[model samples]
Target: MEKLNVNPNRMELAELKSKLAVAKQGHELLKGKQDELVHRFVDMVRESKDLRARLTEQFSDLYQQFALVGAELSPDFLEEAFLSSGNSANITGSEASIMGVRVPQFDFLLPKDEISYPYSFSYTNSELDASLRKCHRMMQDIIHLAELEKSCELLANEIEKIRRRVNALEFMTIPQLQESIRYIQMRLDENERGNLVRLIKVKNKIKK
Candidate 1:
């Protein structure tokens, strides 16, 4: 705790008291912000966990389905089918504010033209086609899940920063200010008592 080097006078004491009040108020405001950040971070963490689990399960199934289809089809033919079958999405990116942090938001623009599967029927079976379509549809979910994970990463960083600030004010700044105030008051009281004793001695000498 660093003590301010200043004369222990009434004027300096008043100034220090005012500074202390301002520090306390700022500390309260920071604490409130920290609480809100923590709340948002907790929600994001849960969402991220759920999304990751879903993606893992769905992707595993997709891989297995593709593998089964591969056993029946030639490698060259399967590669050609996959290369031709991928669908394109219309994605628009935007920014959204959560608390004070800005996170990314995406909108998928629906195409006016009818959506069709990319693979030819001659080369692909029904289950193969179905898996391909399912994977295409999940593109949006995959993008959204990516967005959520990135948001969580950003929120985690901000949370750490706010935590440090709150800790500094709570454990260090407020206490130091209070201690300085107490020390000044103690010195002022001692000075007043010394003055009083000297005045009394001078009066006694004058009377004699």
Candidate 2:
């Protein structure tokens, strides 16, 4: 309940009143914004949790598939086979605005449209082929996971910022303004009473 340092005059009182009005309005707007941001943050957190679970399952499966394929082939041959495929995952991403937070949008460039395997069927074993297909499938989920992770990060940061601002207005700024207004009113009233007392004394003297 800290009051601002201010004079006890009508001009200062009017100025304080105006400030209090604006402060209250700003506090209301910030409270609304804080609620909205919290809602968004909670929603994103749930999404991220789901994505993480799915990604964990997928990655575990993918790793097991890779390990099985690795045991079936020599290291040199495995490297050669992977190199012969010449297929790569190209990623592109952009910024998407969600509640003023810039989240990421991701897409993958897979060779599957023109040629999925991009490798010779004669030399590669069935294990290699199967593992490669699984890898390709996993890349899509990996990209989606990336998008979710980034969105979660941005939302969390934005939520923190909004929360801080809301706290400042609700607890500090508005209270200080109201306190200053009350102090100014008390001072003005006291001054008015002193003037009235002076006028009464003058009247009494004139009568005497």
Best by TM-score: 1
**How would you encode candidate 2's per-residue C-alpha lDDT over 1-208 as one tens digit per residue?**
9788888788998987888788788878867776887787788778878878987887788788778877876788777655655576688878888767778899898755543565567766776677666676677777787888778788778778878887888889888888888898998899999999999999999999
95 in model 2: Cα distance from truth in Å? Answer: 1.2
- Which ranges of candidate 1 are over 4 A from the true structure? 112-115, 206-208
Q: Locate the minimum summed-lDDT window of 10 residues in model 2.
A: 111-120
- Among all candidates shown, the one with the greatest lDDT: 1
Each prediction's TM-score versus the true structure: 0.89, 0.87
Clashes of 1: 0
User: Which residue pairs show backbone clashes in model 2?
Assistant: none
- TM-score of model 1 (CA atoms): 0.89
The alpha-carbon deviation from the true structure for residue 77 of candidate 2, after best TM-score superposition, in angstroms, is 1.4
lDDT of each: 0.81, 0.79
